[model samples]
Target chain A: MDQDQKKETAIGSLFAQWTKSQADLWEDMIRMQFGMSDASEKSRKNPLHQTQKAYESGSKILGALISTLSEPENLESALKGMDSLPEFMMHITQQAYEGYLEFQKKIVEIAAKIGQHTEAYKFEGIDQNIFKVWRDIYEKEFRQYLNVPQLGLNRFHQERIARLIDTLNIFQASLNEFIYMFYIPIEKSGAVMQEKIEQLAEKGEIHDNFKEYYNMWIKTLEGHYMTLLKSPEYAEVMNNTINALVQYREAKQEVLYDILKEFPIPTNKDMDELYNDLYILKKKVSDLSRKLEESRGV
Target chain B: MSQTNIAVNLILKKLAETTGKAKIKVRKASEVLLSPLDTELSKTPYEVVYKEDRVGLKYYKPSEVKHKYPLLIVYALINRETMLDLQPGRSVVQTFLDSGLEVYMVDWGYPTRKDKYVTIDDHVNGYMDNIVDFIRKKHGLPQINLMGICMGGAFCVMYSALHPEKIKNLVTTVTPTNFDTDKGLLHVWMKYTDAFLMGESYGNMPGDLMNLGFLLLNPARLILDKYVGFFENMDDKDFVENFIRMEKWIFDSPDVPAATFHQFVTDCYRKNLLIQNKLELNGRRVDLKNITMPLLNFYGQYDHLVPPEACELLTKAVGSKDTEDICLKTGHIGIYVSSKCQREFGPKIIKWLKEREGEPKTDKSPETSRTPSGSKIRRETVKYVSPKKIIGKESKPASPDLKKAK
Candidate 1:
């Protein structure tokens, strides 16, 4: 092989040798930083299912709440069993936050290394973008968290209380998965950043072809992704987050529908009723038309 | 151009490729962008042979037909079946057609609120059954080859298990039959999912919500990197058109029927009933032992969504003696779309089906095919390592054949 061809092979081999041990270490670091690595099977069984019954009419919901709240510090006591905002906002989030910082360090290192090798495209400090994504998600989630203090037990209205607890549960779940959530964009950005390397490879920045460069990135990214995805923590957090959101939307929708019913105008429910009636009528008409046509041999 | 000038130009052209080529391509991009592009899918000359509600059976007549039995493609409800016929040169349907394989794809059309009552029984036994019967009657044959993709593959497995008499050969690509494994996060999340509540609340599972969850599975790549990569290659007309086609297929997901989703999660995913011979549909048990047809189960080596662990167990769990599991060197969608995968995937199925064709059709009951031959899985292809061995070792991560991933 020629000198340039040899160089490309060397670069390709550099990627092929990336060991599973390295992937495990990186995955562990990311999970540990987020407190996801510490989540046990016991922690996954958070009493989230019991909240489903809280979306009933105010009377039933209030009756259930009253029955539960008869015990001293019951709701607060249950909330205590789970990690509060302070635990994450103060202590548990530090390692995860630092993990993002470490991720930025790696991004910088990878980006600079590729930049030095190619001139087809300039990778202008991609680490900054990763950090920006991290900061933005954190800020947005914090704003969502700030809405929680207003939903205190002072509001005894059953619907409002239901929405409050559900919303808090979601907010708490978000806090728990904050690091991993932020890391998803980062995990994907690795490929985006690889475009710079690809441009370089095309422009003779690197002797190897763009396809080789892309495969290297895929191998690297897939390892980190597969490791995280296979974890019990990732599964638990994903399950909790989606379940919490589904419940929250259900509760909010019910409460909103009630308020909308108070108004004389059409709400989602009124429109849904009208639509359902229309659909059934349409189906009946179509079926009858089909029968008529078939009878006439059309 | 003189020899000296030519020599200088050769060196300069190489240098120009570094930066000059991109500028020239970008300048040409605007001209192509203004004109209408043909990004049409399911365009391989298919006619709707039969229609049942929103569901339609699209038949694509091939240029040449050498096979005895017709092949039916059962695609997942989550996304449109147009991925099979995505583009002119890159189409899976076209590939099969070029190889003299008659193709029929099931278009599980968009579900509405009215479809909330549709269950697995309604799909596997109802719509799919009708379509299979239609194909059989159309061909004047008793049985036809059945091929299903993703969720459709799961349905094919169910259908084959339930009615082994109707299928000559079964090919399930990127299908998840053994949902008990925790390797795939979808299985885990579904296990914990309150499907009953979600079903009642939404009527039908929202397509947008499903897309959001899918995007989260690989946020960095799916949400950001994909589009950015498209932007990077926007100058290439073919690349841009292909990107647009893929984008259309990806976002064109249909809402799943609520009852179907609930049963799928509860029975198949949470309870792990199907593989264990406990799932009941239409008052009859969906015994896996009934999947006794000549089986070719294909999965993407790098499929994170339906990991090999989720798919690999099916070859053994089923009672098929002629079962072959081929792990292609690509991810889920890439199994059909990727250039490298296209070379091996379609041809392999064509060959596997042809070998098992025109055999004396024996219509056997579920109990007759329950003979276990778990070790009969053929590993003749490139590097067939057991998914359990790789996924079983705690520290070692699953490594797909990455050289061919793109």
Candidate 2:
């Protein structure tokens, strides 16, 4: 490659690397924030009280799953040793609740930013004589809040969470009953049967009957989940999330440009005049853009 | 340059003569033509001061309309019903009131989310029922003289037919009934529309949308040429005022309830249910044969929205032997507000009603003699077509057999 081409390739690689690192950083941040580093800390309740109960329940199930994964051979041993349904239920509910809690935090953060910034920026050329256009948008969003069964989440989000919780609860109860009636009795009598059950648990695959019940619960939950995902509320959140990421990248790029473009930070007096002139320039440019658009029937 | 140009200029010259007479006549009648007492518009006759869902009627009773029997003006729901009583010298309400007729107009109010569920049945059966009941209670009368314009005329026809005993005499101007005619673009569009989807997507079909559809029907005239001509003559105050008033009325539209919109486009327009006598209002069959009262059906020879062919069917629909179809040489709105209408058409309505009611001694004997013929009414098959078709579209299908024809 020529010198210029080589430099371009290097810059492109650096950008790709930076983006990959950013994604990793986010995942790391989430894990640390949730205290997933250690077993004891992983099971602890989140301090965000609204999500605390849900988080605690989810983390506990996640803790059990992690324990099983670390020592797969012992899962068979554990299953054989297991006596009651309550323990299984406790784990399932915990994991489901934690996933929902994570979803909640992400949703609220995005929704709040959209709610604030949408007001800060006005649409460029709507006729002001048409009264209550802005007010109607505000009213619809306000009504959205009321329509939600719970505050902070959209209607579809709340419905999905409810379905998840419901399915987990039923699965937990039913599985416990199944284990108590069948598995415990077999495990108590024969070492060979206990070993077989332990082997199944270690593989992370239970008997066909257990799998059927679990799959049914998942299927029900998924039906509600897919519906929620397809909803306008979910689309808004997903769009806003992507937009936030893009805007953050743009702001970062602007910071780099500012560092490159300027000699140094300007004095306060200079900054005042600079901002004023910038604003005037922005207004003039906006007017010019509008005139162009109007001419083109845009 | 064009045939229309020569005809319009000649009409305008005749309009100027009528204007001169009107100015002189209005000056002499100013004292007697003062605003009506104890009416909502007494303070400001032009503005909408009162609106009510509770009372189930929007009474645009201009202080100017002061005849003996209050003229109940019904306008098409597709447009605001305010054109008849708009303002000052150009108003139909003012002309009627000046001629001594009390005016009560119906305003189909703006529909909201709650009103989105409203159907043709709710409007025709419920609200109309309440309005008639209220009027009856207020006036202590068994029947009221009714005037329906455009779709409102169609609604009045439905109401009158369903409850003939309640309508003393029926007057429908520019009302369309026979939709089978492929004469108007609007009829063609309505015939082919997917009303179900339109109703489902937009809970209330917007009047603005409907207006846009209408404006598209004759884009060269309505959208471009008319506006260009209007701007050219913008300096003339009288022309501008009348133009503005007409524009205001044309643009001011109410969103129709989804169910009503669906039924109107599908049942009436698409299926041609009303004219076929298969239309049902609130589970009750609407048979035009039930209408036996005095009927005066009028249509403009030049109305594009409701072609003359579309509107002339009313005279034959009713079992009323006393029906009169008055075909005028004007468009839809012109039949009410034009200077020609005042001098030529408005007087016709007053004269007909007076004859029907036997109010004038000279016309009383003829009307009295005609009362016996009403008893000879028969419920039978009849071919009904608006006189608009016979005069204009020569290729239109033969009129069905009249009850008396057989």
Candidate 3:
């Protein structure tokens, strides 16, 4: 055969191999979807079942393209199959928009609940309830997106970015909770001071000395803060906040390492290695010097 | 007059008075704030005699050296040693100097990333040991008076145990030897702290973060009330100057080396190993029973950082029979800075040291000597002895001028 004919033959075989692999993957996916449906009636009613159905439809289109490519004579059929690509993408986009809308609805519902609680002056429950609501929403609805499996050559980098984002969110949430806890003392102290002032007013003994009132309020605030700080709940929240911060910083450092790798700037990993070596060398020298001193009886 | 009218009048009168006072205060405050005030810390002149990496030795020589052995004061790495010499009147360094006693202090300079691997062992056995040896050589004495403040006290305790012959008199102020207590918020929090993770993450524990933790311990006082006090006393130049000085000192914190911090929090705070004498440095166990020298321990009664519970047990745990623990009625910083404590704390320490201050070594015949306890001791002239020889010895004070501390 001529060189051109040989090259064309080689390309045809490569395309056939690619088609076979894609066909096998689609077939396995279909079989898994059917198996899942058959295994549990409950799973068939799940949100993931809808995703499987969408995947099944996309798989049919892909199968058509694969067959047309393998047959080589069905070029027109492949072009016809390609026409469904935009529709398939639109279907996926619509699902995503609906999911986003659902998320927004949940957030608005929680926000409305918070507004109602605040309007009623239920200060005691407001902080706790708000923190719970936000934390629950993030963990249950949004955290999974950050934890989703990534793919391709940039999979690790993408995963690091996702983790960094996830950790940042977690850190902010914990920090907000901590700040709210800190504010509770102020709120409680204010209520207590107000009660004291009201009692003084009732007795017709309200003092003109503002310093005394300030002292009273400050002391009450301090007492409340002391109680709050000493509590196990406060300790737990503080620990969580600190841990989240550390995790976020670590994630950020990892991402920075990737970015810095392209630049001439030495990363923390490089410096740490150098530090370790220097530490060892210094320690060895110190030990030897000490040994020498001892041997010399100096 | 009607009740409403009387109330209105009263309110108006109070408001008028407050406004007048505030105007005067503001005018005075502005003048005071703008004035050049001496808020400088460590005002007592001292020369840097030795330096090792980031650490330095500050020597504050007296007009006349009254004591035979010079004192080596090791302040905590958490804060600057300038706290001792905050001001002329309140300066602990000055107090020691005025007593005609030679004073030497360790300035543990700021730790960078390179110092992350510097452990407690490096501190107690390495820097401290070298400093002690240098002093011993300088003075031609076998041992010197060793004093430690706060975390530095912990290091001193470890050093004294490891090299008993190198320390004549051991004094620990606001030192926490026993960490198995919930009296202090620090102890409680440290118990739950992931020290290893913190060390690994930050390389060195940042000082600002520690200060933040301290502020959180008493937010109403440290954060709010402190600034409130400053604002209220803004008109008083002395108060403002003193406040600024204190502010400078408090915030002038150095990062704790990561490995040292990790080991301290783990071995001392988490495990409570120091009191148990289970703590080890440089592969050698720090046995409290090895500290045979006279020990004077002081702790503040209201010290939230290092409570009496964290310090009082040290004297009882030590091998020294002449151990005294004085619980001063003050907070952590107040024990040194408070005017009331200035009278009691410095005088008491000087008196205690004087009582235990042995005679100077001379080339004359060996004479009989008396200890602070009024016991007669036979003098013996001897050459320099190795530290290892005196490590585990249970020797008592044979002579006041003896080279061996025991």
Candidate 4:
């Protein structure tokens, strides 16, 4: 969507929210006029003593909404919170790709700046792939850093977790693509609504009935999401994304268990094994007990 | 100047009016925020009949038992059975009891690391069978009414097929039976998923992760619009409380047992083996032809998770002569919670069950107290799939050598 259009949608949504309060007020008036509502029942449902609890809950919901609705730099940034979950997945995609692009830009700018003072470089073995060398060095350093005891993971298990995280990054990246695909409708409707809002704003048009357009925008987004949800590709992507995440988790845990094996601690693996044995034994005992009781005519 | 002046006046007036309303809203919302919020869910009372590791059987003793066979509500391992009795008036369990039916539900509690190896056989053949036997012994009946929802519905279909004699009548709401159809995204996705890798990763399917997957399925509405709407409607104590309750349920998903998840995705979703008579539990095959009891299959017309294509084929696939189906004009979850659906869902289900149970149709009034809006339901089609023809289909495939000789 165009910048103006995006702004319109954001403003329109705010106005729309305000419009809902008006509607609620209208309802309250209608109820008062009719004297149809039961104050006793309402109070019974929301006793005076419950005001504090309601405030806390309402504040929580409001706080969450305020945070979520805060204007983002772009649609993608809006969706991607600062250093959120997708980042901690150990593999980076959005940030990494953007980071690489920015890095290239910075390097070129630095080179250009340096050229003004002196020759940019000696161009010694310039024919070699420089990118690979840098990438390899970075990986090796990152791996080493991961092995540091202070890094949270033991030295032996860091490599394994690193590998898992990297593998998981590929899966998460693909999953992210699918998730972003699911957002296309939201973006589309938002754009359309934004465009209309912008046009109206430019024309200084009086949108007396903003509620209808607001509802349309929500419904349009919902309809699009629902439609996209049924697509075979969406399902495939959604399914594989989870599997990928699970694979990474399993690898990480396996590494954890391996490291835990040398120590005197009780590991997840040991617990799982014990649970399995106990479950099977429990079933056997239950079945035998039932059988014995049946035989004894109990 | 005239047009611009008029527009400016209108805009100013509207802005002032909106600001005043906004103040009221903040005040009302603050009042609600400060007030005690009872966002309680699953308020219906029930006692534990049996417990097995992460699984338990809950019995909601009826005020007066009117049915010969007790009803067993089997829920999917992924979500809690609390959804059936989500709220007072909206609860399926409540509706059943109010209609004078014995209600019992299987609660597949949160699975731990130890539960990673529990397979489909352990669930349907082992636990479900044992539960059925226990209920039968308690009630002193030969059979019971079996109902399932979503994955639980699939389990019911499998259980009914494997042990037709144990179920007097079957009710499946939004159950995905025929997985081969490209009706839903879950089917398509599961086809390519590495079930073994998933099972190996976490002992049980992480409930939170599964919940995340569900959120991703409808990101636009679920992640954004829904949350915004909740805040917008925060002034309404009822709406806010209900929203919180729903949030609690949506997030209360249980991590599925690894073995069960593995088999479900691979055997059912990937291979579409159950409908094809190729699915095996423990050592025996789950033949859909064996589900010969009276069946009432419910499906939402617009259920994205389990579409009509996923549910409608069960009658054709099964060997039930007295099968009925109700396709409600709602989504998967709406049938249980939507105000429009509350009237049709519980009432229709109860009415159908009552008719099959030899009770008069007019025993209870229709649940049409509220003006029925935003909903439509297709009448049940009692289709017949002769058991002999369906079940008697030879299990043996044609021999290669014999074919060559011929």
- Model 2, TM vs. native: 0.47
Q: Which runs of model 4 end up more than 4 angstroms from their true locations?
A: A1-191, A197-247, A279-298, B1-9, B193-196, B359-406
lDDT of 1: 0.67
> How many clashes show up in model 3?
0
Which prediction has more favorable DockQ, 1 or 4?
4
Candidates sorted by DockQ, descending order? 3, 4, 1, 2
Task: Report the C-alpha displacement of residue A242, candidate 1, in angstroms.
Answer: 2.3
Candidate 2, residues B1-406, lDDT tens digits: the string is: 2121123455466667767866765554453334332211122254333344522344444445444455566667776655665555446665665566655677777875445556676666656765776677667878888998888888998988888888888888889888777666567656644434444344467677677666544333344445544544444444454455556666777777776777887887788888888999767898988989888778866566688788767666778888766666655565666554566556667766666665653433222222243321121122544644322222111111000000
lDDT of 3 by residue, A1-298 (tens): 9999899678777777888789879978787866546437887788777777788888888887786687645544665698789887787677666656766776677677552322212233334655666676677666877889999999999999999999999999999998988897887787788778777776677777777898788777767776777666777788888888889889999999999999999988899889989989988999999899889997
Report the number of the highest-DockQ candidate: 3
Candidate structures ordered by lDDT, highest first: 3, 4, 1, 2
Q: Extract clashing residue pairs from model 1.
A: A33-A96, A188-B220, A188-B221
Candidate 2 regions with alpha-carbon error over 4 angstroms: A1-298, B1-68, B361-406
| RMSD for each of the candidates | 24.4, 30.2, 16.0, 28.7
Stretch of 10 with least lDDT, candidate 4 chain A: A118-127
Which structure is stronger by TM-score: 3 or 4?
3
**lDDT values, one for every candidate:** 0.67, 0.56, 0.79, 0.69
In model 1, the runs with Cα more than 4 Å from the true position are A1-180, A183-233, A259-298, B1-25, B63-65, B192-200, B359-406
Each model's fnat?
0.15, 0.00, 0.35, 0.49
Q: Candidate 4, residues A70-115: lDDT per residue as tens digits?
A: 4344434655675577666546454455556655765575566542
What CAPRI-style quality would you assign to candidate 2?
incorrect
